[model samples]
Target: MWYRISSSTVIWVANREIPINSTSGVLKLTTSGTLNIFRNTSDLTPIWSSNASFSVQNPVAELRENGNFVIREENDDNPVSFFWQSFDHPTDTLFSGMKLGKNFVTGQEWYLSCWKNSDDPAQGEYTYRLDPTGYPHNVIMKGQNLTFQTGAWNGVRFSGRPKSSGNTMYTHKVVINKEEVYYMFEQINSSVSRLMINQSGKGQRWTWLQQAQKWSILYEVPSDNCDNYNICGAYGDCNINNGPVCGCLEKFVPIDVDAWTKGDWGSGCTRKKPLDCQKGDGFRKYSHIKEPDTLSTWIDERINLKECKKSCLRNCSCMAYASLNISKGETGCLQWFGDLKDIREVSEGGADLFIRVAFSDSDREKNKATFIISLSVVGGVCLLGLPLAFCIWKIIKKKSKLKRSKGILQGSPKGILRGSSKEHSNMSQKEDPDLPYFSLTTLLHATNNFANSNKIGQGGFGPVFKGILEDGQQVAVKCLSETSTQGTNEFMNEVKFIAKLQHRNLVRLLGYCTDEENKMLIYEYMPNKSLDWHIFNEFRNKLLDWPKRFHIIDGIARGLLYLHQDSRLRIVHRDLKASNILLDVKMDAKISDFGTARSFRENETTASTNQLAGTFGYMPPEYALDGILSVKSDVFSFGVLALETVCGKRNREFIHSDHLQHLSGHAWRLHREGRTLELVHQNISQESDYALEMIRTIHIALLCVQQSREERPDMATVVLMLGSNGELPMPSQPGFFTEGNIVGSDADDNTLLEGR
Candidate 1:
């Protein structure tokens, strides 16, 4: 909001947090020639000043075209020879070529601090800059906490930022040549472009598009959950494509299984076998990874990879070492002395890091070879029994046939799945015959070996691809990564629960497969994909008319009812939310993603757990806050989903001008004002039919999301309320939707908030 004659808006304020309330406000040069902002009401009150304690003999100030306001000696007309400049200290916005780090000689720190909120210019929690210590990784900090981290300088760009390397739009660098350490970006095109650190701490680079009369987002950092700092603690690695997300490096185990099982990885992993420290100690190479936190790291440019490893091995205290520069084929040395933290495996763009461990952990291979030879000699004599081999083949054929009988086949990926135990067959666990399986070859051909074109999207679980089988049937394939922390537990949950479920409203689980290393699930594809895609997308929302939206709401209710009461297993779909609701070609809704589903006996309906995992916004107050779950928990999520559908907005990401918490808060406000219809999506309004049904549906949604779990309506009653012309009960305020005391905008803005 900076300006022209038509509007005198200050786009960038020098002292934004301080307001000059009276017309008596004045900007003047003092007797000593230092400039300051002052008001008549309080002569001594200085809102802002040049900080020139000993003023120059002749001082002058000027605003450069690049938006730098500088004060310097009048005799020195050169712009670069300035005493002070506004660009040196930033507030929320960063322009091209701004130094954002340290002037070591002067002990000065320059960084970007976010405004309090979107409109308030007061300082907020987020700060972005080069943290000069431990080799200067660009970081985004929320107060004292590290929210995000970029690549450590790898002699090129930040080593972890693939996007920053080889970019034509701008040249980026981290300069640390003794006098200072700083990070700065020089744009190829500087006009009308600014990189803003939004109030939410998102680093967004916007370039104006004259033709579209809009700002285009070039890219942003903390792009996904993996960018979160120390998401996986010491000796653990984070892969966003994994369930439970955090996992230990090979041979390490969770320090606390109870906490990790409940989705807490803070007490990460410890060595299965501790290092013997130079006594039969060896370095295990970890490829394709972002290095751990460098708080206690040492770096030297003069050494090569060979010298680096030797130096680390020479020191008993050194825990790990890596090449300093990723660009130059593993050159230079970077060493960590103590605990390793904040490590993650990258899908692409990462360096190789080697961790030292004891040789005892590798001794199993030598012992296993001896065991194999002894077994081979014994099996030679057993081969004389031919009739037994035929019997074994017959039993396997029978099992294979039974697997195909249900229109789903089960098998392991060829040469991919290893029993993690033996040579005859690699079976990690006892094979379950309840669900059918799909062979890896079949799925590979169906999805082009999981090609990018076929990829629909990725979630915490892994990458999902849309595939076409030989029978002309389209299916969605979930390729479970071997490194995924979900392990076998979540996979079995989806298999056990979705297999026996028979309902039009529920997603059909065609089958599942486990190759030597690959784990996959085949589900019937939905042409319309997930509910969130259509409802939250502004352009797509127009396509979903009021009738279609109402239909979806009804379908979701029926699906939830089936889960709560009609299903063979009295199951609770614990992770229900918009993204979990898949839509078929005709826009019919189906409840999906049964990975978190839990079944209870009819007599036993409620359960509790210490840790929680689910999208945040749709989680019930009782379930989320206290871990009590039941059919009512699903009902609470349904309430949020239904409300979002009607409003064509997301509960978690909703923004309000009035400072309301989210969509639910705004809806509650509208309900009290007798203007609930105003909460409906603008696109849905053109078709005025079903206006009354729309209003009634919003009321029912409110009843479903009431703060008290006992007051909320069950899914069965919700269906009756929607289908029949019945009066809805008065609803209380929804959970997490107050005007004050909210953590984030969306309920399930889907952070690793489960740990909280």
Candidate 2:
């Protein structure tokens, strides 16, 4: 039988299948506390009954405001412990506060099944609920076949939905606890809105407008053909605005071109060349794109943006990555390790997606350097004749001057020693008089009059500039800034230290210029600048892959080893940080800036100074607090730098929750907790042994930063630790333990030493 509720609406019933049938279907309470619904006429059989497993003196049944029929004892006031309710056995519509997901632990599912037809209330073809498998997300299935899906829930919002802003009518959340993974939405105004899964297999939001006395459509999903489940296929982007509306990404073509031309894009696209597991595949970043489907992929929420790229880059199977929620300033990362599907293009609110491409495409895009160099060589040959006459004239003048000076000082070895011996009694007896000296004018011209634009960077004693010599070779000229507090003492220190040192890892001091009010030291230009540049910038840091970073770490270790042991003069670099480690174009690491370097006497083991000088956070506890200096001080700074490189965060400003302090301190705590792997940056490939090596590096760093100077490792041991997998001693608590103050406050507020 079917009862008409309205002209277009009917409540269907099978005579015997559903025993309950009547307009006045009355369910009465008995003294035994059981309520039974009976037919109004004697010939009518009893319909449905509420046989609640509870006893009470009196019971009552009533219809609720939300259309739920319930029975409860007369004296019982706690509504939560309902005896029987129609909501537990729901019909078609899912109201607010109703769960629509599985409880895996309990084997219970609260899902919505579409009605069979417009007039029938039977179960139909579609079912919608949350899927808890593989990074839980909401999914819709049409009779056991997956049709539509909402991407995984990031910390802030659903990955599939464009982040919402400026509206507060409804608040939605997806919760995943130990017990269950479910999705729910709550309305700001109780009487305002409702969500429904209609018979057409559509999920929609409607707002009740009291003024209009009708439901106003707020939003609806599956908005168009592009929104259809996996309509564009794998690695294909669907855009309604495009002429074809569906096409593969760059470097990719349709798997079935004929099907694609016929507007049947379900076949998707494929890469022209298959990825070689060992090589020949790289990622290309596509900005402002909807990420492809990630059904069976692993995701690391804690990984930073750089690590996300590296993680995908290292694995040949990994295809792409995007910010889990783009609006959160790209905090979380999602990686697709297999085939990607259901990608689309939106005019706004899409994330940047990086797609893997064959190596050939990467080579073509990266060939600009060769082309530019070729043109430069060709141009240089053409201009060779133009400057030949001028070069000859200058060379002749220089030679003439040199000849005149040579005769005047041909045998004046004693005179040269006399002038130099007066300045330094400890000078080597065999000094070379031919050491080159640049005129002040020549230095000034090379640096473009010391314009700020030419200045590449600044250090403790001065500003370094990018300079081009008359011969067209680039040089880095370190000029003492007039306002520097170190003055001529520090300048002379750098010249004296660097002039005597010759090592591959040490920076080369090409020459120096001395004139009234001008003192400058020139070195070969480091085109890649400093290690800090790449290690600090989020996007640029991605360029420093694990192998490159590992190489840099080893290079720094070897340089320090040479300074402390192999060099004729034992030197201590008082200040060592990422800023001091320079990189050449090939990414080879070079140590630079010796303004504060000190040389120890042959037998002296340590030195003391009343003045403290070095960058904060990288300073050794003893050197920063007391007036002591030693090779151990440099070791401490090196340890801090190592941790910073691995963690990709500054030690001084590292923050983690409410309990961890600086990066060093937090890393130590994690080490103690047996969770040091948590310290590794997410982008690092686990397949590589970087995690195990980084943990070892962290322990070694901690050993170097120990509170007691004697407890720290020397440069030799540090080098060995970095180069080999030797057994290491467990480190004690590092210096400056402040895990109690995880949320770092102003260091100045405390009576700590101000300078290091």
Candidate 3:
């Protein structure tokens, strides 16, 4: 076994199966182009051999970076030269870049066999491999008895494991040629990944986190009940979200609805009416469905979906048909004959399947489709009219808004104002020397001229769109909206401030775009969008479990602490809310939208001004009413954001069952009543272990949003309280707990878009 510094754990084991009681084993390459593993015993017999008979001039054996031990010619005469390689005979671990399939000509099969036990090197009963007996699909077996199967690849990804398609850490590829068929994944960056089949028969992907100095689970197989083969029986779609987890396809009925309702779903569905092979017999297309089992299916590589459908129609035995790969155009055909077994309906996996149905059912479906098309025509007309009317109204609004914007520009701007647009652009380049300058042409092409399809959301300053650079790097482009009240000052404030700051929890400013007509900033794109994107929605909130929510709270606290003390200069994020918190692929929260942020010197603890800015619900009483600003103002906002994350509801949008108090007041009441856990997001509070952690979070939130600035803890103290298990001070009444008492409660927060 070989070890490395990043991790002391065993990375590679040479002589896995053969054990020597005394002298152990020695792995060496022979004089010939062959590698062997031999146990150092009195008998002196080689236990494992590369078995390479091919001869090469000046042959040498070496191990490559990808953990491939190969014996090949020394020179570059033959680049593809490989007499033998250890990758051909993998033990249990499947490292990234290693192929997991078979070579037809060589008759060599590549698969991952589970280790017998933690201490044993023998292969176990479970085997995870690509089965090419039929249409290719990754499968798991318990000594030849199939347990789980990832539905065959449909061009983009496996029908069952759709998430394998768009993983950020790695990209998976499959190749089928005249000689070989294999599946391999390559890491996008220099990240170490390992796929191991455990002794229990489960396969999991682990990715090394350089910062955390540990590995995280990227994915796993057989994750749920639906993953089990034939769980829902034949001709039934399994949906884990469903209570029964199984349901009959359209135009079909349960074999025994009584048994099905009683949780005995072994007997799957049957057609209500048999297909008569009549001229009107047609297929019903089901979208977002996991294609049926492919063990007994027929596939044609040359034909398209249309050709496949024709073929299925001609063969009366064909039960269902679907396109093999819909990643691009419809290419290849897969037809399932007889009964469709192990079918599934997933939220976001697989392609559409067209199943055969009786003529009567087809006619009814046609009639329904006709009615829907007619209704859609009416709806389409209304939609077109609404957009036209909205555009006209928007034009008028834009003109009036333009007049107001010009009116503000007529006078010289005061404090916290940039000298001018020209100075704002020049000074940022001078001050933020490390910041990249993206040309307008480059940005325009990257964002498709700010196409609506690419637009992710709107901020106070402009529209934020997701863009891809020429290098395939995805970024969020924040272009200044023509009607935006935020101009030179706020723009420069963010560019200069965030450009100087560096932290994982702080949104990184990749670059900026400046021109006569455009003022734009480029940032690392957040795939999961803002915190408000999830918490404000009932269904999406489920994605944020208590652990994830707590993680975000902790991250936000650390980010705030960095801004207050750790950074080169003390910074205050004036606009901190759910909408301002962006989540990365790992669900790590990053504080974004720093256009309204302020900076304080080392000795400055507080600052006061007549200019009051920030969202209503998040602003503290002192900051909103008295125009006093400090680290506490940001702390108050953090408190509100934390409450929103835990409650799974917006601060201002909170609707109480008992009374009409805001979210903060609701939390205070719950705390006083010894029911602080009740205020937690319903989706997360189900776990008893995390109940205490959640209650403590709510307590910290209350302490941060205290009515008086003096009572609120500093960002450092808040971070300590969140990290340690130490007792916290009792929280007083939080500001803005009541709607009427909130300053600018009814006014638009967009007014704060412009700094004083």
Number of the top lDDT candidate = 3
Q: Name the runs in model 2 displaced over 4 angstroms.
A: 1-22, 27-90, 325-329, 359-756
Error of 1 at 49 (Å): 0.7
Candidate achieving higher lDDT, 2 or 3: 3
- RMSD (Å) per prediction: 16.3, 25.5, 12.0
TM-score of each: 0.54, 0.44, 0.55
Query: Could you tell me the TM-score of candidate 3?
Result: 0.55
Q: Which stretches of candidate 1 lie over 4 Å from their true place?
A: 1-12, 22-24, 30-33, 40-45, 53-58, 75-77, 159-167, 190-192, 218-223, 360-756
- 554 Cα displacement, candidate 3 (Å): 9.9
lDDT value, residue 690 of candidate 3: 72
Task: Output candidate 3 Cα RMSD.
Answer: 12.0
| lDDT, each prediction | 0.74, 0.68, 0.77
The parts of candidate 3 lying over 4 Å away from their true place are: 1-11, 19-24, 38-43, 51-59, 73-77, 118-121, 163-169, 188-192, 209-214, 278-280, 363-756
Residue by residue across 1-756, what tens digits does model 2's lDDT show?
Answer: 111222332222212234443475554666665655566645344565555677766666665555445677767778655676655554445555556677768786777666676445567777777787766776677788777776556666655555464557777777767787778776676555655555555665666656534454454455444556787888888764354568887778999998889988888899887777585566677754555656777777788778888888887778877666544677667778777888776433456677777766654455766788889977876778757757877998887566433321222111111011123312321242334567655766787766665777776555777788897667888766544545556766777788888886888888876543356688988756788877776755644555566667767877988888889889999878888899764456798878778999878878888776667777777777676888888888888888877767788878888565678888888999998878766666452535677778788888888878899989988877876678999888888877442223322111123343
User: Which pairs of residues collide in candidate 3?
Assistant: none
